[model samples]
Target chain A: MNIALFGKLIQLLIKEKMAYRGDFLLSAFAQIVSYGGEYIVIWLFMKRFPLLAGWTWPEIALLYSFGLLTYAIGASFSFVQMRELEGQVRQGTFDNLLIKPINPYFYLISRGFNLAYVAHITISGAVLIWAIGQLNVQWTLLNWAYVLLAVVSGAMIQAGLLTAIGAATFLWVRAGFLFTIFFRLKEFISYPLPLFGTFIQLLLTIGVPLAFVNFYPAAFLLAHDSAPLPGWAMWLAPLVGPLVYGLGYLLWTSGANKYQGAGG
Target chain B: MDSFELHRYVYKLPVNAFREQLRFCMDLLSVGEFAHKPVRQLSLGQRMRVEIAMALLHEPRILFLDEPTIGLDVMAKDQIRQFLRAVNRKKPTASPGRNLPGRSLPRASLPGALPDERRYGVTTYMMFAVKSFTNQLAYRSEVWLRLLGNLLAILIQVEIWRAVIGSSGQEGASLDQMITYSILNPLLLALLSTNVSEAVDSSLKSGSIATELIRPLSYPLYLLAGSLGLSLYKLAFTVAPAFALAGLLFGVLPPASPMNLLAFVAALLIAMLMSFLLGYLVSLLAFWLMSHFALSWMLGGLITIFSGSFLPLWFYSSGWAAVAEALPFQYLGYVPAAVYLGTMTDEAMWRTLAIGLIWAAALLLLVRWLWSRAVRRLIIQGG
Candidate 1:
């Protein structure tokens, strides 16, 4: 639970990844290209049509960058943890954490601080800055602070989202399928949600609430009258992440408490 | 029956035609308790039970089991022994015997070695092909999830095309054709592209591949057969379901001509072969590559971009589309989709199919040569 211990874990993970320098460099480049290909597809679509849902290519780029930035920041912490949770739960390996004095959730979260997402961060971070520079938004201190805070909130929302999904492993015992669905569902939010129908809009805002991860914040920042549901979410954007994350934490605790010993 | 049932495929095999045998084997082995569960959820003992049930499905004349009761609990071991005894009472089956790599294990005491002949070549090779299908039986959930995702993907793309084309309509493409393109492209990809790279990577790293190469089998041919079987599995589960669901919901157009339909099917067969070779060629790089992450990432990106899987070549700029056309990757996605979309004339479709086969053959030759070098390297490394 200590902050220093968390920092040490991260440092250890980084050092471990850095040991394979050739692997590290080549994979980083490859990941950039892999993700960068999707961006090119979006750009190509834009080439055929000047605007989509009344947003220019740069504007769409800004929205896309928001999703990537938050995803990279969020997944860097929870990707490995969430991905491996089902196996760990099934095998009763999570019991390994119960033996330790430290909080198991914190311990679980620390080990997931993967270094692979460095490439994701770099691409998304660069794209965010470049897109911001391209736009004509006012350079005010309050706006900058909201953007920064919203980015953190977005990351927490993503992390919380995966964590909540991962917690279901306790109940189902085979929750690996949900993470696959999680990825496919993320594609729904990558585009302007307005392009979708009322059903999709309602689903994103209320059902899973992943729209808060990128769409709502982008709308709030750009001062566009987007996010048809929960109109007040724009003003209370900073609270969104913590609220979802709290629910996720609650799910995690209850699921952990329900756990029986190794035999199950 | 759940999609996990073996009765869906192998319809011609009378043993597999009945679900009764499946349940009987499952119950006998005690795997029925966790029949709905994924492979990852199973313990070593539980997995052994599932494999045992699978082997018992066909009522094998001589099941080549090795250490059947190795990791099982005392109860499970007794159950397996009892079942084996019951089976052996009716027909001969495996007994406690060690199998040597060079010798087959079956007859009276030693082994019933099959005389190596070209006549049995196909029957021997078919085992590798069927292996790919059985391997996918572990994850029934993945199949359904992928189907849902596929339909959603096609829906989104069709919607996107609507937005782009607008009321006035597009330049060279109609809304219907574009919708067909959206559905068919992903369908072709789902039905054809088998990730044989991961198979190669694992075999090489784990040294399991040494057994494949040292044997008379052609490793690349082995991979090709596996991929073909995988595509066939996908065709039944993924492609057929998605095609029915998408066609029903969105109303995908029929072929421009009956000839186009013929060409589309032919193109797909060649594309499947072409993709397996391409994937194998890239995966062989792990022999010298630092990490598979780089190769997988790079190859995935390059294929997605150049194959025009995400976007058809027609959607690309004239210059960009031409670049895609120049590469062999186009046959993986664009050609099949384009053929179905009726982008090519009748004769042009035939030409494309011919070219795809040639490319597949050329890639196979290159793979064969590279494998020779790889085998030589393994020998030097004292494999």
Candidate 2:
């Protein structure tokens, strides 16, 4: 929670990355290429069969842009710890964090920063903007406020999901494939959620709460008649973020207590 | 550009093993502790046998034996030396030009005499890793099945293209047809190649490469042989069966001419070589970057997209398609697919082939440059 610690971590990360110029640029370019190519598959799919499940091109763009915006925010911030948790637990380095004066969770999350990963955010933003222009939704101040809320809350929900999954690693030590399952589901989620079979749609909406991040918020913004979720559920989309994050924190704290710090 | 050369590079079991054996030759070393355990895990001598057994995995043609016995007691070193000599003499040598130099050493001298075919100018070489009839039988069946599968995929792709285009037309279908033709090929290739390459590339970076590199042959050559061995297995077992299924599911037609068949074969070979070389060059970047997975993932994705594998470059705007043709990606998939469908003329085929050759040459040079630099770094690091 200390502002100084966050500032110090950012400065250290920039300095460490600057020392390795080749890796920095290459890694950035690689991220750009990887994200660009994956989205291109969706683009081509849309181009081939436009208006997927009654969703137009701009609606699809919104899904991608908001989804990615949240992903980047989570990944570049709180969920950084999730990526490293497996290695930290297996190596028994969690004890060092526990002994520190500041919050162990804060230090753990702030330790790694993928500066190169912002390329994804940038590309996704560009695509989103282009799609928004084409869609040309009439935006009032209230609409703008909702859009802002969606962006921030969407990021929280995404990060919270990852944090919760990552915390599970402390309980289930060898959860290697869990990450892959989340990744595949995320890719599937980037598309319209309704195209899925009934069971899958219910699972995604209720179990994973993927709909709250992009699809629901997008349906609100477009104010289109065909949104799958009832009008009342649109209001609930933004709340999902804080709710999940609160639950994730509780789970993470419990998991932290169980750590025997064997590697330490 | 040539598939044969690509085969040489990817299916390099002979060379990779040889290099490892040669390094051990100058100084035979072994440790008995299970890997990932510390060096102190076993008696010093038991470890040497593990080293010898490990070296045997490559089935090296020329093994260098250094002061292998120096660290060991007399009895231990003798047993180790005898093991080395036995492997050296029994190992089979792949074809010379098909192999990188220093790796294609002659089959063993005394214990297993070099086959008579060297006299007839057709070198009789054994596939060094196994010798038992049962093993050979199992391997041949596996290879046959793989080839069958690949052939089946190729046939299915052709039938799909034909259905989209229809018969009796003066020309093959347009860009749509080409894209349809190439859609499944790269996906299958990606599924097969990417994970395996990642595993090997990571192992090479993490010092296990030391075990592979110290053999009689070059490391790259050994990997090439292994890939070819796998590809052969795939072609027999996978491609042929795929062809049969395509024939049954969608009635098949003979190629318009033998020339069409030749062009298809040529294009595939070129594509495979280009893909393998490009893969190797990217893998060598691991020496500079701690992790090459991102690079591999990015490159593999590009090859799938821009290579006209998933979608034809033709579907792209004229400017974009022109840009794609200039790159090596199209030469890997689209060019051959088009030529095989009889959509491309002879002039176009030659042009594509020429572009492919140039790309292959550039990639090979890049690989050599990176490998030399990496080797020097290895020497300095004293790994």
Candidate 3:
């Protein structure tokens, strides 16, 4: 409703943060180093072993890269879910947006920006580039396009998970720690989801659909040598992110209706 | 937009302090050393003002000020209070700019105002008595209660461990042997982790250190005393009940000997001291850093993982084990547990003790230097 107010908010953020150039760079650098180090550790392990539960190096790379991209986008844009909803609720600041003209969810999701998270993109990109060099896959134009689409959709799916958790806060006030459990579960996405046995794979495919963000795409890109999944599943992988996000949005709206306004 | 309303939402309050938030508020209103100085260099009072200012940076709709005036002169307190009042009144008059989640006003009753009437049933009185026993016993009591508490918590834990070991079909490992090893192992591990700065540092920020600092008592002794108090309370209310419930619900084993008990207590005391000092140094870092939360959190994670509280560091690759051994992280929780479990050697115990001392001295010096620097900065800045 007030685009000017939104611009003013952005301006305030930029203006306030501009003075802390050293801090900003230091924070972002630290995040990149720590997360990059973690990724390298995992990657190095995979390289030594060559394959994990039958998934090859490049395929693993795709999964890892896509997961990082989705996570990075989510971290860069809407990572406040990392703190969970309890803080805002406990602080009694959850209603600050309720008095505003715009949707409270938008403001809540974007409120605390962690620019450091974008550093993950750099780390993931390096991993992808290195993996691509090692692999012998012919990159088609459509494959590249699908890759871009997959990244975008993966971001949506990741955001959708967080958004759903954010929405669920209206019902379960203590759902803040539950978000931590979700993030911890994301560690499973770093590998081929199917390797974990049927029950977990089923849960990831349908329940969380996190597998679509990484494993499926990686399987298709690397071909059948490493990945057991069919090529058609690769196309389906890209769709799952958006479909999950749409479903999450539907749930979000339903939950939003329960919000009792700032004064309530 | 009321400061009081904001405070209600953000802080839990029995409002205990060496000097409470009100003192800081009162100081800001007065004309004195604090009034003339910039907040950063004005002693603890001025430091508090700077802290409040920092907290207000994001223009928090609801802000919690914990013990805002712990060591401030009266004049400084008045100014802070006046500043808070002005901020509260003027905040909503201007542009509310960003649309955060909540209104400035709190929606529910303040935590302290609600009466806690739910009783823990028949054991409630016993628990209450256990908690208050130290307070009732008055003279030179810090050491007595502190040692007693540490002794008791370790004993209980060892007893539980012994019971577990006995049932697990490990022969020649008497309840006493198991208790001794369990206590020593955990103590060593706890000591090791105390060597790291993170856990020790954050605990200090809880404002638990101020009472110890202002008192004539040495920092370690005071910490030991407080920890002892906590341990005693934990033993009665936490360990006893936990064991009781565990035993009643499912069968349990008890530890074998009093010597194992003594060794465990000794190691645990050292570990507790190490933990407190570690946190003390970390909190001291706040004087230098904007907020030590992220750094502390990261450090805590590394320590926890390396220390092998989740799983034994021995189970990690030999390389990781070397890394863990090289640092004090393993001493935090794992060593003491391991010692009590009879896993660590006498040589390792001595090494842990020596490392604990080195860490303590290093941290003590660091804290003193940091404190001096912070005080100087506060004096120069006058905030």
Question: For model 1, what is the alpha-carbon lDDT of residue B152?
Answer: 78
Cα displacement (angstroms), candidate 2, residue B104, comes to 37
Q: Evaluate chain B of model 2: give its TM-score.
A: 0.59
Q: Looking at candidate 2, what is the lDDT of residue B304?
A: 58
CAPRI classification of candidate 1: medium
Judge candidate 2 at residue A76 and give its lDDT. Answer: 75
Candidate number of the best DockQ: 1
lDDT (10s digit) by residue, model 1, range A1-264 = 389999899899889988987889899999999888878878877887777777778888889889998988888778789778878877778899877888878889887777888898899888889989988898799889989888888888888888898788888877877887777778887788888778878887877777888788787777666858556677566788888888888898788888775364
Stretches of candidate 3 off by over 4 Å are: A1-11, A40-51, A55-62, A81-96, A224-231, A261-264, B1-279, B297-325, B330-365, B368-383
lDDT of 3: 0.56
What is the full ranking by lDDT, best candidate first? 1, 2, 3
Instruction: Kindly list the per-residue Cα lDDT of model 3 for residues A1-264, writing each as its tens digit.
Output: 456665666677777767887666655565565565455444444444455656666667767887987878865555574355666665567667577677766666556655556567877887878887888888899888887888888887887887777777677665655565566557677766545546656767778878777777777777653234456877887787778778777777687678664232
Which model, 1 or 2, shows the larger DockQ? 1
**Residue-by-residue lDDT tens digits, candidate 3, B88-175:** 6656643322212232333222332122333223232333333334443432333343333333334434433333345553443445
Tens digits of per-residue lDDT, candidate 2, A1-264, equal: 577888898899989988987777777778778778767755654564466667776788788888987889877766557867888888777677899998777777777755765778888888888888888788789878888888888877877888788778888775555565566567656766665556656766788877788878887777654245687777887798888777777788888887775342
- Which fraction of the native contacts appears in each prediction? 0.56, 0.22, 0.00
* Model 1 spans with C-alpha error above 4 angstroms: A230-232, A262-264, B1-120, B214-216
Worst lDDT 10-window in candidate 3 chain B: B106-115
Task: Give per-model TM-scores.
Answer: 0.83, 0.64, 0.57
Q: Which residue pairs come into collision in candidate 1?
A: B107-B112
Give each prediction's DockQ, rounded to 2 decimals: 0.55, 0.18, 0.05
Best by TM-score: 1
